[model samples]
Target chain A: MRVSYYPGCSLEGTAKSYDISVRHVCRSLDIQLEEVPTWACCGSSPALKMNRLLSTALSAHNLALAERQNLSDVVAPCPFCFRRLKSAQEEMARDPALRQKVEQTIESQVNGNLTIHNLLGFLTERVGMKAIGEKIRKPLTGLKLIPYYGCYVVKPPSVTCFDDPANPTSLDEILRAAGGEVLDWDFKSECCGAGLSLSKPEKVCELTGRLVRDAAWRGADAIVVVCQLCQANLDLRQREIGLTDKKEYQLPVIYFTELLGLAFGCASEQLGLDRHFVDPLAVLKRKGLA
Target chain B: MFRLTGALSEQEFLHHVVQRSGQNLLECLQCGKCTGGCPIASEKVSGPRRLIAEILSGMRNEALKNPTWWYCVSCGTCMTRCPVDINMYQVATALCELAQEGGIAPSERDIHLFEELFLKSVEKYGRVKELRTVAAYNVITKNPLKDMDKAVTLMRKGAFSPLEILSGWAKDRKVSRIFALARRTSEGGHE
Candidate 1:
């Protein structure tokens, strides 16, 4: 039940709610999360786009720290961090020369044997659904939710070796176990135009507009997500998307962990539910689950 | 050295891209499945299909000048649908690096600038200070008001802390060495 946690930079800044909810939910679920010490950025899309070696090295640096912590399993709540760390582990294990170069760059030995899991993976695969189901004190009855995986959690099948790349069911299964209505949607693993929010804000709005519009069309109370970028895009951009699309898409994007925490009988404030831009509390109250 | 104007032979071009991306272009059937599922593909961006065809034709300049790679969201939808499993994301990364090396101007300059600024943040602080990096990007891009509303909203929601603007110190100093080594290796054309 003990695992090293890598919350990445987003959780520290724009997605503090995700970090808080993750810790709070884990505490309620009896999962001990030991944070990796002084963990740096995973290099994210910028590192991957600029230089391959540097990205790998940045991820390797964190993995080395996790290795130093003597934990075999490390869980990253951020999909970008999870992908970077998992990709680095794969690259290092496959290429000895690249491994040597990354080791030299990091100035630390990388055994490359660590099991890197995205938070969803850690919850569904590591912590069985039965165990999670056992702890649900307040079932999310009548709350229709659609699980949005975004991109990195289960895509590029070779790198992220967890869940179906195209149509992932882990998030759905978890939500279903929480006694919420898990609606089937096509954009479950769609792109929310991550990182483009800065470069092409309009494009991000268009892409995010689609997801928000779709969730509203499907009659869902809220969109459940595990990635911060997706949640931010879907939640924060709702106003703009509504203005542009000329429809009132007031769908609340809630974190899967936050919903699970609520199902576990934890208060909304305890799980950082008050932090969402679109306000998920209204939907929860409407369902009489609050 | 890669030439900006002259195109390499189809074999040579394919070999270089294959080596850089670690993807087998030879296995690509031109099924266009990647393009069909691409989220960013539009009339402006030709998606992975045209890029792959350009590579097959040894149109190095055309491929490098193309903005398809720049617009890619790296969603991996193309990879999942690719019958041959050629990751277009990796191919886009290779093309981007190649274009930079060849001194070809990126079609989407802001994205490249954002990437550079993001890396600069990482290099300086071992982690990205979102407020500082976004502020710097906004200033450099001559649009200081970009996402100003989101910034204020995030600040009000307690997601963005104002003190973060002054926090650029790297908690882990080893990141400096990592950047230095990566630069040397990249300059040496080892990656």
Candidate 2:
């Protein structure tokens, strides 16, 4: 029930709700969480364009610290950090030369012995759905929730190696376990144009607009997400998307952990029901889950 | 209408790309699956199919000059769906790195500027201080007030606060070493 948690930079700044809800739910489930000592940014997509050596080095530095701490199982709640940590491990394991180069560059030895896991995997495997269902004091009965995994959570099987690259089901299974009415939607794992918000905000609107449009059209009450960037992009930009498209799309984006906390009978204050830009509390009240 | 003079130099460049990316250009079967799934392809001049062909055929300029790489989100949709396991997303990332090194003006300067700011911010604070990252990026990009409205909204909602900016500085002594060493290797020191 104990694991080392890596809540990346996004969790603190943009996705504070995720960090809060993650800790709340884990404490409810009695899963011990130990954060890494002095973790740095994993460099995200920006580093891929800046320098591979730097990105890999940053991730490897954190991994080495985890190894130094003797934590065998490392879990990253953020998909971007999960992917970066796994990539560093894969690169170090596959290419000894590159591993040596990275070690020399970062001045740290990554044993590559840690098991890197994402949130979906942790919830489904470590915290079983059966156990979760048992904890639900208030089943999300009438709440139509679409579990949005986004792109990086599961893709490029060689890199992520977590779920089916094309057809992922862990998020759906987790949602259903929490008594949510999981709806079948096509944009489940689609791209949400995360970093494009800064570079080309309009493009992000178009891409995320399609996602929210589909969820709303499908009659889902709200979209439940696991990634912070996706939550921020979809939740923060949803109003503008509605304005630009001139549509009355009022879908609220809720973090999966928040919904899980709701099911566990945790109060709204613990769930961060008020943190979202579009505000999911109204939707929750409408559905009577509140 | 394609020029065919600098094949050797193009081959060398392709070789370097293959070596850096660790994904073979020849493994790509021109399957067009990558091009078909690319979100940024519809608006770009060329998609992954043509970009891979250009890289393999020694058309380094054609491959590097294309704006497709600039707009790529590195979403890995193309990489995952490719039946041949080409990993064009990684290849596209390599092209971006090569473009930056070769003095190619990125069709989107904001992306490059953001990259610089992200790296520097992490290097300095050991974590991203959102306000500083925003100020540094906007200062250089000449839109000093960019995203100010959004920042205010996040602050009002309590999602962003200036207090967390230096929360990790106390334990940053070891984290600082990682960046210092990476800088040494990046400057061609014992790679």
> Interface RMSD for each candidate model?
1.4, 1.9
Worst 10 residues of 1 chain A by lDDT: A270-279
What is the per-residue lDDT of model 2 for residues B92-181, given as tens digits with 9 covering 90 to 100? 667877776678887767777787788777877788766667677778878988767777766676766767654545445555677777
lDDT of 1 by residue, B9-121 (tens): 75567678889889888677888899898888888889898888888778888898888888886778898888888888788778877787888888899998998888888
Candidate 2 lDDT, A1-290, residue by residue in tens: 78889999888777888999999988988888899877888988877656778889889988987787677788899998999999999988998998998998777688899989897798888788877877888888988988788888887777998777667889888888888899998887888887777777777888899899889889999999989888878887777888977887778888899999998998876777776777688878877887
User: What's the DockQ for every one of the candidates?
Assistant: 0.67, 0.61
For each candidate in turn, the TM-score is 0.95, 0.93
Top TM-score: which candidate number? 1
Candidate 1 to truth, TM: 0.95
Off by over 4 Å in 2: B1-6, B142-150, B162-173, B187-191
For candidate 1, lDDT tens digit of each residue in A77-130?
999899999889988999998899888888889998898999999999888898
Task: Give the range of the ten consecutive residues with the poorest summed lDDT in model 2 chain B.
Answer: B165-174
- Candidate 2's TM-score on the B chain: 0.79
Tell me, by lDDT, which candidate is best. Answer: 1
Candidate 2, residue A16: Cα displacement in angstroms equals 0.7
